[model samples]
Target: MKTLLNVLLRLIETARILGLNYRDLKNAEDLLMHNEFGLCFDTIITQMYEYEIEIDDELYESISKIGDIMNLKPESYTFMKELIRDESNIPKPLKDELTRIITSLIE
Candidate 1:
């Protein structure tokens, strides 16, 4: 499995491909390096949503897998659930992963 930092870097690369400004994530690398997992994850997801970046299933699955390691907070869970619900274009696999996370939270 890819480490969280590697995932974040991949997101940055995606942002570059989309021509979106990725300064927030670039700055947040320090947080991840310092072991600030929650903030790093939150920032990546928040920026992705704000920029309206479309995540493919493979990348989304990687993010989902790392969520537990990040120790996501309550609001992070809510944010993810909302992301899954609101993004109509989300790929099925990505949606399924998000659904799994939200369902796990509910249980």
Candidate 2:
């Protein structure tokens, strides 16, 4: 379950990197479903750290909409915190980038 979640999260990160809309997760899913799923979530998370993508208010609104469709509570900080905790091994750069992204969305 963790692995799957991490894969999905990495997909989200990748989508962000490519300037893909988070609200359009179908595109992300389609892009990732074909890729090999063998990599460790830590590795993917680390890559996310290496890449910095800005998350603005528009992105947050889009994420909230996507979360709603996916039955995820975007308003909850707990899930975000848990993601950060579980991905603690991520590189400082990617972690900082993601932190800024998620933080902006939360606010």
Candidate 3:
């Protein structure tokens, strides 16, 4: 389960880094279920933050407004903090990308 979740998380993050939008996420979700990831709709919000990818205000608002329709939940901000603290579990490519993204954001 953990490995599956990790892979889903990694794919979503990779898609985001490649500039995929929510629609892309939807497509990815279709593919994700086929894998052993065991991801539920509720997990997407948490996964978004886990990747340190930010959604704009309008997108965030939209996510909040229609989350139920999409079967997602409002993820707790603390999820990000916890995810960020667990670097040892992340893949090297993802870790490198995240570091690049964070560095660019800071600069």
Q: What C-alpha lDDT do the candidate models reach, one value each?
A: 0.63, 0.45, 0.51
Q: What lDDT tens digits, residue by residue, belong to model 1 across residues 10-63?
A: 756655675456587575676777777667677777776775556555556566
Candidate 1 error regions (>4 Å): 18-20, 71-107
What does candidate 2's lDDT look like per residue over 1-107, in tens digits?
A: 44455546654665567554444545445544654332322233233333433333443454444445445444431122222322336645577889999999999
Best by TM-score: 1
Per residue, candidate 3 scores C-alpha lDDT tens digits across 1-107 of 45445545665665466455676577557756665232433345455654455444444443444343334444533343332334337654577989999999999
Candidate 3 segments exceeding 4 Å error: 1-28, 31-40, 68-107
Candidate 2: count of backbone clashes, pairs at least 3 residues apart or interchain: 1
Candidate RMSDs in Å, in order, are 12.0, 13.2, 11.7
How much is 62 displaced in model 3, in angstroms? 1.2
Off by over 4 Å in 2: 1-50, 75-107
Give per-model TM-scores.
0.54, 0.30, 0.33
**TM-score, prediction 3:** 0.33
Model 1 has an lDDT value of 0.63
Give the better candidate number (1 or 3) by TM-score.
Answer: 1
